[model samples]
Target: MPNPKIFDLTPPDLSDYIAYPILIVSHDAGGASVLAAWVERHLDVGQCDFLLEGPALRYFSGLKIEDSQRHSRTSLVPSEVSRFACVITSTSGEDVSLEREYIQQCRLLAVKVLSMLDHWVNYVPRFCIDGRLCWPDLLMVNDVYAQQLLVAIPGAPPSLLFDNYYLQQQVAQVLQYRKSSALESTQILSRRILYVSEPSTDSRYNEFELLERFLNSIFNYDYFNTQQLQVRVRLHPREKLGKYDELMFHTFSEYSINYCKNELYHSLAWSNTVVGAQTTPMVIALYAGIEVYSCLPEVVEKMTLPFDKIRRIY
Candidate 1:
């Protein structure tokens, strides 16, 4: 671990001495969102090349890239990448190997690689490929808590604290939506709950199991039975469309159960309460002044979200 570098309001000037175009790469949804926000806020779209796959392709859509294509780790040519000024990537999940492979290849080619981490968990494991730690030249995180976590890890790469422009934008969008919408008063009067689901990558519980527990807990409360409660579950981008079909069949009779059909802000605006384990959408909901709850089971060691405003339901 080294002393963390903190950047000010603006992103680092990557194009200062660059002679070639910058290459941006991402795979997972979380990382893709962060990288897409960074590129939109800081970089010149025309001068960058993008190699987006998975959910990243969706996030980076509508951007004007010099060359944007999906390529696997094996298809990434050394000679082609060596021509770039540098590589900027997002740290993806363990299952994804493209970012780690890019880091190794970039290192071998002496190309400066900067990797941005999207979430707070799995700091060390993100860079571990084939039992070897593939440290980038610099790792970027959004906040002080993430910076501290990375610094605590043994042999962690140097990290930079950059502003989370994505979250800021989301907050702004929520505020703008609330001001323009006429149904804000009525929405607050109703008991609309939104459960944002995430893949249980670091937890012992899966989405279905946790959601069942949540449903059971709410059902026991007498107030929920009397009130007109509307419940909707928003699945993670990685989750399949019909992943919660079985759960819906069993719980539909108890309450008006449905899947979240709208976008993030739209869903938040319609809900007065949002629940999740440690997903990022819950954070957005909190920023929008919605009631948030952590529904992690008792079997889990502890809650990972660092926000004190989020109350624990279990």
Candidate 2:
């Protein structure tokens, strides 16, 4: 998939963000919403500002969290930094280079930095960039598994770790929402399958090759030939389908191939199985009680995903 053509890559105005005492920064929709929910519950007015990246900001445009879902005092913005209090950010460890500018600004401002774990991978590089370790004052992990993995990093201190109550609650709430929506669906003919696609720019794996392998796995399956399922491809927020246009046009003529625009929770609700490689949506799928399968190449096993059994496609 190609990147978005119309996104505003420019950094948002940070003045509004600095007005609040606490700042919450997130680059992904899941992390931003989770942080937003947390801010709404714990922080008071003038206490916190929720800052999101361009992709995350656009993805949350129409979705409204109920008054009850948020605290009375919370500000949501598109940028961040400052000296008032603390700055909290989440990272899955994949895009450390991209966040350097923001992180640097926070450092220069001497803002207390708190980093939240997005998933159980890239432990060392996620926090330790440019040979500097313990970049954040506080590091939050979602579960015991994350804690274990993070603490094992050579020089990472144990005292810096804390449980991510906000993420835990978000996971529970998302699961409940998906579970409730399942009863409302009336479509009974086509068993839906969600294919969560990631960008191929990363040096670790080729998205095109992995996609080909996944397609071959499904086409060779005798049950898939029965045409009892519908395949819905959900592109990563930062990804576009331009690269897959040719392949999609040439194949799956007998079956339905849809590009999902709804949120991942909704996508999980509409699907029976989720396929991906080291993606957080797979974790969300499992939380929503949907089956998940791994489609990563053999050399990509370095990805330390949180799943217990990520069944390989081939």
Candidate 3:
């Protein structure tokens, strides 16, 4: 059996994150949206800003949180700081590697670290990682991959094998409507998603082409239930020079795929079904118990058994 995942207690009440505004930097494709949505839900009072490297500015800003999600008191973090934090936060075009001394310097200056659950540790070099296990601050990551998070802080509250509270909360919400009678009333329309994409120069495989081929092949096949399907293409975000756009098309799809109402896990959970290749959205769809049909049959065969035994493994 695999070892139990570890969780960490972040020093929440530190003077570093005191009265000053918090610049939450999110660098991955939909990572900013996830962070912003979470803050809007849980820490509405914190003065927050979204930092962007130049190319990514247009894309993340395009998916910015609406004012409706903002509470009455939260202030918009200024642009200068946003850019400054973004540059300091951003590492390189291919990977987001934070310099240990640089991050420590930011810590000394009281810049609070704001990052997605997956990329949070990349922000800090001091966190511990031992092959299968990587401890980012107090957050418990299952493996060196750093794909998942705990719902509760270690020693603070008991949590399930999966730790994301928002995920837990959202699961609870969707599950409440799971009964037979409940299913009858709810018109669960599954949208056909076009995880539209290109390939990046850095990646070994052009994920965009692979995913596109996947979608083109299986979307019309009878294997997947299409009762609620409405297919659409993913639109890439606008770009700027000098910054690493999450949408940078050395490759698309995973890099800058359009996430409509059909996608899951990035932000704005999709009610529709996923139609694409292997990626983050696929993982999230399985978690949501939503319908998933893969273009890659071989990948599906290998991944399905482990997914079925996810709970038992932990």
Candidate 4:
């Protein structure tokens, strides 16, 4: 079978988003945030539809999505999606098995599909099935490295590779929004350390050990014991609050664990240092001029985007 035709269409104005809505999907909160930021910039309130699942529901809970337009993946039927002008999704490795079926289904229905790269790692894993790739009609990526990787796949269409200008635009827009919000906040920390935590769901890296190492790194630091350094841990959407509460309360009760209140952009603005393994927020922090440290040990190779390559962009 031949590869589907890929189009590198120029994005239209906000008016096009309202007049011709699209379906947005993502499996993680961070990925969903990126999508939401783009939607906020391009689509008017209640103008678009979403098939949010996994962490996306939690991340977008605060946004005002109409009940009619907002739906879970399971709730979305073929007939419903067939009407969409196009489908846009942040590729997910865990959901690929299901996504492949959905992709095939969409193909039969003649609905166009687009996949957005959430990170640089797993470039091939997210879309491949049984050594064969399930290609979308359009692919959005931030850098040329990704474009090169995607086009190398057998039967891949190079024309499908387009830059995710929305993500870059979001960074600027979010930073400006949070900068103004920061002026109104009275809370002060001599040194704010934002610890972005990822779930240890997979056994590649030990969650407890990672946390222990991070804590030790902080406590043993020259200024940590002093009143100057303050640390706050932001849990991933997939992480349970109780796990961290128990871990921190017994080992280090002083550290604060935040869930919904910890907006990624606001935390990045408030923090002097952003520490994490390999998360989208770390890259965002790096772009925002905040210092970042990789906490994941050597064993977890291929699990995250290469920070070295991402740093080159800045």
TM-score of predicted structure 2: 0.73
**Model 1: per-residue Cα lDDT over 1-314, one tens digit each:** 22345423354454432344778878898888888998888777777777778999888885665444444455665446787888899978898887888888888888888898888888777888899888888888888778778667877766676788888888788777876886477875668999999888754777778888888777656434546678898988888877888777665565688898777887887788899999899888888898999988878756667788998887
lDDT of each: 0.79, 0.59, 0.37, 0.63
The better candidate by lDDT, 1 or 4, is 1
| Residue runs of model 4 more than 4 Å from their true location after superposition | 1-22, 39-48, 58-66, 72-75, 79-81, 95-99, 128-133, 157-189, 201-203, 221-227, 254-260, 300-314
Clashes of 3: 15
Query: Can you tell me which runs of candidate 3 are displaced by over 4 Å?
Result: 5-21, 41-104, 107-114, 119-202, 219-230, 235-272, 294-314
User: Which pairs clash in the backbone of model 1?
Assistant: none
CA shift at 312, candidate 4, in angstroms?
A: 15
Arranged by lDDT, best first: 1, 4, 2, 3
Candidate 4, poorest ten consecutive residues by summed lDDT: 11-20
lDDT of 2 by residue, 1-314 (tens): 11233222342333323334665566665455554544454456345544555464653343453343222113421133553466767653446343444455667666766665656655666655577754565555556676666445666533233344544553576566656876336445566678998776468678777776677667657434556767888888777656676556576555567788876667776777789887777876776666788888877655567567667665
lDDT (Cα, tens digit) per residue for candidate 3, span 19-132: 334444444443433443444554432344444443334334534444532321124333234223321222222344222223343444444332344232222332222222
**Which digits, one per residue and each the tens of the lDDT, describe model 4 over residues 168-282?**
7546755686578773253354667787887654676767777777776666665345556667787776777766665677777665534324566777777777777777778
Count of clashing residue pairs in every prediction: 0, 1, 15, 0
Candidate 2: C-alpha RMSD to true structure equals 10.1
